[model samples]
Target: MSAAARETPRWLAPAPLWTARTVAAASEEFLRPWIAELRTDSFLADFLSIVGGTDGRSPADLPATLPERSDEDGSYRLFPSHSRRYYLVLASLVCHRPGIPDHTVQPALGERALFVLRRIRQGAEKGFVPSATDTGTWQPATAHALVPGERELPLHRAPVAAFAAPGTAAATLGMAAGQPSARTVRYGYIPVSGGDTVADDVTTTYVIRAVLVRDPCAPVISAPTQPFELAGPLDPDAPRRPSAATTKGPTS
Candidate 1:
């Protein structure tokens, strides 16, 4: 529950799980500050991999802003859920697509990799209904280092404190992998029916994707799925944080 709701009436029972409002509030609590910082700061040098749409739209095709409220035009976009989507984009640095001539950045990772990337950002909320369909393993470098039953690595420390568990660092990487190398768990979802709702309502383990950055200065869990160019111009029209008065639901 949100810190504000910690005190309840003596007559009411404690909330069994963090409410949707609580989760949304929490996501903002954790993500907004970072967004604000990123807005003014240099994107800190690093390679990046922003997710392009399933149709493979270039990152340039991605709107300058992300969906902050459920009713916004970008609401139907991927990285669904609460306003967290807005902040995630703001905190990221978009790079140029490697081989494409379009001058736009591309999302090279498959869709399932994208889902894991977002859920990790959702932090430690309880209701984790995954939006990706039919999960399977595809090994990547980080997965090799942190898979379940393996010793914890320095990068294994909570990807971010918001979504971390006590043993999340040591937590099993989940079911067996297809290869001994790090396997990527990929899934695709059709937001048509209750699709976006899963991102909002369903609670699953807040698992994040790990990038195998060899650099000592690199962040463990990151926004881009993989390293693109070392540097590129960031999106000038990236989303900004909304005021408290114009509040929306929790993505905490």
Candidate 2:
């Protein structure tokens, strides 16, 4: 084997096949330090204050915009932390998703708006489902992409009903901070709202993460259950130190 390859740490497996809870606990343990930092960091506290009360999606853009605590730099290669790329997993929480075209299928616009308003008022008191509006396009709003009176569906009266969810803290690329980042969103459906469309039923569409699925916010049905992570950048010329047992010199 090449010197570098020989030096690589021999990977080990957790006591054969581990249980699901074992996995979750392992992941929780691994990320404990980072999560603690987030809980106490003044920067995060201020950012949470900015994010908490607002009617934003759970772990939404607010999390995306939070400044990365790691020193961000562009020059390092083989280092994932250089730009502090991140992924997040969040569970169902009271949320407001911006409505879009699919929600505007009904012919009579007025009726559409009315139905959503009624739903909001009648929805469970625990969560506030906003009344859907005729215009919910924020991306296009600033660009003046749509003409007046030509109202497209906007997200207004949406509520997340899913119960307890797991949370995972992952890194994020500084995309919002003028750094390059990739974001992908995947829609999830419940038994009530999947498959071929039927008229008159509320089509529940939610992000798998209970928020936007982007580089900053990711969904995790299963997280690592063992002590594992990507290997740090390996140096080709570095010497490999012997293991603890081998390194101990003979007692004189």
Candidate 3:
């Protein structure tokens, strides 16, 4: 195995479990139906607020705010106060696809990562969440370390908080607020390597974070099996293994 392959972390198994095409197809199908069921503006607002850790409200407390439709495009988009970052992340993760160009997924992944970081920071500011360490305090060190020159991107404002967990650092971005009180978020990175000598062949280590929110009755969102079928075949030797995808239904 190559050096990069050897360094592959155990947490990033989900990214490679199914190919990018599979992820994208599953996302479009599974998520479109789920979002359509919401059908209310406040439903999305509360969902975004809860996910973003703004007021530390649960999905149950969300008012009846629905997304406005674009007269020109006829697509549903979140309200302005809603974080475009979180929406994109949820969309990407729930809809990942295999064999698609990295250029497409990269932007969504980066945006999601930044969204989590911002949420953690916001939680810290509101005293809803604590930084990574157990000292029960926030520190600059808890922030994510950007790859040198990549800091200039508007989405790069927040730093990623690393922890020993199952998902990528990006997944845990906004989960800090619910830590100890409502949820525990874990963050890490997955490095994909192989193929070419140039940067083109270098698969990025996607930063992913998973939020374990407190919901005894939360509905489980099923991971579609179609993605696996679409992606050629899973590498038997791949380090981290992918499991069925499940979402902790509306937080309440």
- What TM-score does each of the candidates earn? 0.21, 0.15, 0.22
* lDDT of candidate 1 over 1-252, digit per residue (tens): 332422211100001112245333533322221111122222221101211112332122222322232232212222322212212312221122321111111223110112222222223311122224643333222422333222222211111012112222111121111212111111122121112223344332222332322222232233222111111223445565443223221122
Ranking by TM-score: 3, 1, 2
Identify the runs in model 2 with alpha carbons over 4 angstroms from their true place: 1-40, 53-60, 63-89, 93-252
Error of 1 at 1 (Å): 48
Q: Which lDDT values do the candidates have, in the order given? A: 0.22, 0.20, 0.24
- Which segments of model 1 are wrong by more than 4 Å? 1-66, 70-134, 137-210, 215-219, 223-252
What lDDT would candidate 2 get against the real structure? 0.20
Ranked by TM-score, the better of candidates 2 and 3 is 3
For residues 4-97, could you state the per-residue lDDT of candidate 2 as single tens digits? 3221111011111112343335434222110101222243333334223233333232323221222222111111222222222212111122
Root-mean-square deviation of each candidate, in angstroms?
20.5, 24.4, 20.6
Stretches off by above 4 angstroms in model 3 are 1-49, 52-56, 60-66, 76-252
Clashes (backbone N, CA, C under 3 Å), per candidate, total 28, 12, 36
Model 3 over residues 161-221: C-alpha lDDT tens digits?
2211233222232222334322221122111122212234322111122221112222112
